[model samples]
Each structure stands twice: as C-alpha cells, then as structure tokens.
Target: MANLDLTLKDMMAVDGAVGAAVVDYDSGMALGHLGGSKALDLQVAAAGNTEVVRAKIRTMEQLRIKEDIEDILISLSTQYHVIRPVSGRKGKGLFLYLALDRGRANLALARHRLRDIEENIEV
Candidate 1:
C-alpha cells in the first residue's frame, strides 16, 4: 500500500494535474497537499469542498438514497475539481481532491487513476 506522500505524488503524475490533497471532511482539514499555485490554494479548496461533501451526504440521507458517492466532479471553464471520498476501512471520513486543467486532462482516465490511488492508499 502507498503512504500519503506516495499517493499524492502519484496523483501529480496524472496529466494536467494542478494540485492534489488528502482531506478529512469531518474537520475540513487537509492531511497533506501537493502542487497548487498562488491562485489555487489547496488548503482553502479542501475546506470548501468539505462543505460540498457534507451537503451531498445530507441530501442523500434525506432522499433515502443508500448508495455511496463515487466521486464529486465540479467542472469550471478552465479547471476540473474532482473530489473522491476514500472508501477504504482506514480512510473513512477522508477524501482525495485533485484539480486538473480542463483542456489537458482526460476526465475519465483521471477518475480511473484516482480510484486506483484510493484503493492503494494506506492513509
């Protein structure tokens, strides 16, 4: 299994990856982060996305949808923000967030790779 550092490094290898972070949605805190420029602060993004995840979970509960979320994709004009909640036993309440350049990223492949990274993460 990969540790947090290795997992984040792997995420950077994805095409068009601008930044990546592992966050705890419960506390809205990032456990680790890599990449990101002055304009894209990974820490702030992680906290903001925690609200997104919590809202979605509340909605699902209210609607009685028992399925788990695969990933949450927020596509912008220039960027794609992918929020993937880690499903492993050790990773409950944690998520992996990746930001990609919309024009250069292959969304499908990035999702697939993120899944792989999630599975292998040791947390």
Candidate 2:
C-alpha cells in the first residue's frame, strides 16, 4: 500500500491535476499535499473541503440515508474540486482532496483514477 506522500504524488499524475492533498476531515488539516500555485494554496483548499465533507455527512445523517459517500464533486467555472472520503478502517476520519483545471480534466477518468489511488493508500 502507498503512504500519504506517495498517494498525493500519484494523484498529481492525473490529467489536469493542479493540486492534491490527504486531509483529516475531523481537524480540517492536511496530512500531506503536493502541486499548488501561489494563486491556489493547497492547505487552505484542504481545510475548506473539510467543511464540505462534514456538511454532506451531516446532511446524510439528518436525512437518515444509510449510505456511504463515494465522493463529492464541486464544479466551478474554471476548476473542479473532488473530495473523496477514505473508507478503510485505518483511514477513518480522513479524505483525499483533488483540484483540477476543468478545461483540461476528464472528470470521469479523474474520478476513476482517484478511486484507484485511494484503494492503495496506506493510512
């Protein structure tokens, strides 16, 4: 299984990847991050997405949906934010956050790649 840094690095290899991070939704903090610009701070992006994860979880609980979240997609005018919660027992309370250029990314492929990366990630 891959470690946090290696997983983040592999995520960047995806087409149109701008940044990637392994974050703790509980603390809204990044465990590791890679490939970010001055205009886009990976840490800040990671922390912000923590709220997105929490909000969705809360909503699901309130609605009594007995389902797990596969991923959350936030599409912006110029970018796509993909938040994937870790499902492994060792990875509990953590997630992988990815940012991509909307114009350059193939959303379907990116999601597939991210899922594969997550499966191999070691907490």
Candidate 3:
C-alpha cells in the first residue's frame, strides 16, 4: 500500500473512472482528489457526501442493522457516484468517493475494483 497519490492513480485507471477522492468524512475535507470535472467538483462532492454517509450510518444505528456499509452507489442517466467508507480502526471516518461515466462503466467490476483499492490504500 502506498499513499493517496499512488492510490488515486490506481482508481483513475479503473474503466470509465471520471474522478476519485480520498475524503475524511468527519472533517469534510479531501485528503486527495484526482480527475474531477468542472461540472463535478470532487471537493464539493466529498463534503456533501460525508453527510450522506453519516445519515446512513445514523439510520442503520437506529435500526440496529448491526451490519457495515460496504459501498453506496447513486446512479443517474449520465453518471454514477460511488461512496465507499473505509473500515477498520485505521480507516474509520474516512472514505473513497468515485465518479464514473454511466455508459462506460460496469458497476459490478467497478465495485470490486474499489474494494481492492480500499484494501491496499495507505493513508
């Protein structure tokens, strides 16, 4: 596992990857970001998405699901937003957010790739 710079490059290599960011949910700050478009700001997306993760976690707590979130996928006509919260004590309150071109990506493979990235990524 390397650092943010190396991992971000790996993420961008995923098929159809548009952008990727390592974000700290607790602070709404991006540890690093790459490939964001003018129409899609990774920093803004990271901050706003932290709330989405928080709310989901809160809801799960209230519901007593006792399960962890592996990843979240939000799809639109032209794009996909994937939010993956980092697990383990070392990864708590941090996440990787990725954007993809809807027509170009395979969701299942992308999810698997993201998992691999998460597992090997270094802070």
Local lDDT at 75 for model 2: 95
Candidate number with the higher lDDT (1 or 2): 1
TM-score of decoy 1: 0.98
Clashing residue pairs in all predictions, respectively, total 0, 0, 0
| lDDT agreement with native, every candidate | 0.97, 0.93, 0.91
lDDT of 3 by residue, 17-108 (tens): 99999999999999999998899999899999999999999999999999989999999899999999988666788999999999999889
lDDT of 2 by residue, 83-108 (tens): 99999886889999999999999999
Q: Would you list the clashing residue pairs of candidate 2?
A: none
Report the number of the highest-TM-score candidate: 1
Query: Which runs of model 3 end up more than 4 angstroms from their true locations?
Result: none
Q: What TM-score, over all chains together, does every model reach? A: 0.98, 0.97, 0.96
The residue-level lDDT of candidate 3 at 34 comes to: 97
Best-first order by TM-score: 1, 2, 3
On lDDT, the candidate that comes out on top is: 1
As for lDDT, the candidate ahead, 2 or 3, is: 2
